[model samples]
Target: MATIAPSPPAALIDGFGRRISYLRLSVTDRCDLRCRYCMGEAMTFLPRSAVLTLEEMAAIADAFVARGVRRIRLTGGEPLVRRGIGELAARIGRHLATGALDELTLTTNATRLAEHAPALAAAGVRRINVSLDSLDPERFRAITRTGDLGQVLAGIAAARAVGMAVKINMVALKGVNEDEVGAMLRWCVAEGHDLTFIETMPLGVVDEDRTDRYLPLDGVRRDLIERFGLVADAHRTGGPARYLRVPGTATRVGFITPLTENFCDGCNRVRLTASGRLYMCLGHDDRVDLRAAWREGGRDALDAAIDEALALKPRAHGFRIEERDAAPAVARHMSATGG
Candidate 1:
């Protein structure tokens, strides 16, 4: 007979007095689409062995739930690329059903959601976020290097059919898809999906010096009010995005400006890379490797490492133009980091 340790309570408030009830975990770095901003033409990827095993990921999530993390979102370069992901979601859902967790979600490019969303929803996932760069097929292909607009749209339809709360994340690139802001909002409204307009992060290939293609959230919202007569203000979501809405439509818009307005003060989530490294912030390279310690020290050692990483988190990320020189330290690009 085997004995299982008792799980921890389901709630714990962090130092910031924010209830730390949610966690986002990346299962693999493998992705089908290579967006220009996240991954360039040619980039090396981590070896298979370097990536954490499914069991390891579950154990980590279980530990997280034991520590009051009631909500978990499985992220990836494209999480659907990972084999048997539905099975992983099923296991997590089992824990959630047992009162250990309350919510389970997934974020993806929606290329595979049409085929996978039903099973994913059946396995306990209740929400999803799809990344759609642009509505123009040619522009989308150019930006993502692989445009399957029809398939992506079908995927969204499939997920919606399954009663999942759908949100679309569109990164507003200055010269690229900035022109589609209002159009994107209208499209999402027509489709009955929520829209989040993310200001390009100064991470990876996009930075302050690369201003030609960088679209600031403020400028976009200003233009929206002046030109299109749309109005935006903060919403009640306790996450990073400040929500907005079209003046006439039933659509809700959002601005996620990590560069212009640092949300670190309200940051409550932690990121675990595919290779089992914990990053305190998406802007910097500060991380603690739990993979190495896991094999030698077991679960207790891993918990201590996570605690130490959290303790080392800085009050805020004061990133500026000068900091571009050290951008490489911020883990891998968003694709590899499973952002």
Candidate 2:
């Protein structure tokens, strides 16, 4: 009898011994809102034909799952803006039910959640991350350029009504909506939603200087500690944010300090752009054109391309805004790469 050989491990481990189990997949680069920090006012959106179809997305996701990626978060300029998103969610959900994927989540601006929340929840999206910078109506409009605060609030309610776990992501910016941090926290606590404060990064072209908008969360974290008696919580959802619980309340606030405090050491995720490019790091521009491989050589060729990209994953991202004038700037925009 011939001896049988063991199969290879089904996980993508980088050079730093980190097992990458999460994938942020961008379904579309088009967005409804034009946030200043995310993109420029006059931007050219990608042609519809350039984007990967829903089937293509599922195929790429399946390949990653075969290689040990169990969790996936659909993101975009705003994922909800993409057509046939409900069907896409259902397709990914089938993978979840089959045990090929563990979780399927989405990060949206919540502009269209009111219309699609029920379908999304029924389709297997159990969790959602909504981006809301300010609760104030005028301030919200100013921040998002064309957003209605009431619409987003209603969308949030719709998402919750559908039994989806909702988390609010606020990109805290100095002189922008930073003053509303305390108010936002209180509102989230009242609504029974967890909140996360994110420091703005220099990923894409913004309306102002990147340094001007950068707001470190150190001060905000200190404020939470002193005012709300905030304490670190021993809860992690396999994401980068650090969770802190408010005493006497079930509400938890998180801080994602990509700038003031780098969490690249614990990085265990990779990104897939809507255009079929695999990004090794968000802060860096290292990418592999998987679409080319798929069209040229099919699944085997794409698997080889993915393996090559995984091997080239950088140990850490060299992100520094202060040194922007000295070093080469990141040319890719956040919209194109997906946040």
Highest TM-score: give the candidate number: 2
Instruction: Score each candidate by Cα lDDT.
Output: 0.77, 0.87
Each prediction's RMSD over C-alphas, in Å, is 3.5, 1.9
Global CA lDDT of candidate 1, please?
0.77
Give the top-scoring candidate (lDDT).
2
In model 2, pairs of residues that clash are none
**Runs with alpha carbons beyond 4 Å of true place in candidate 1:** 1-19, 205-209, 226-238, 247-250, 321-331
lDDT of 1 at 284: 69
Candidate 1 has a TM-score of 0.89
**Each candidate's TM vs. the true structure?**
0.89, 0.95
* Root-mean-square deviation of candidate 1: 3.5
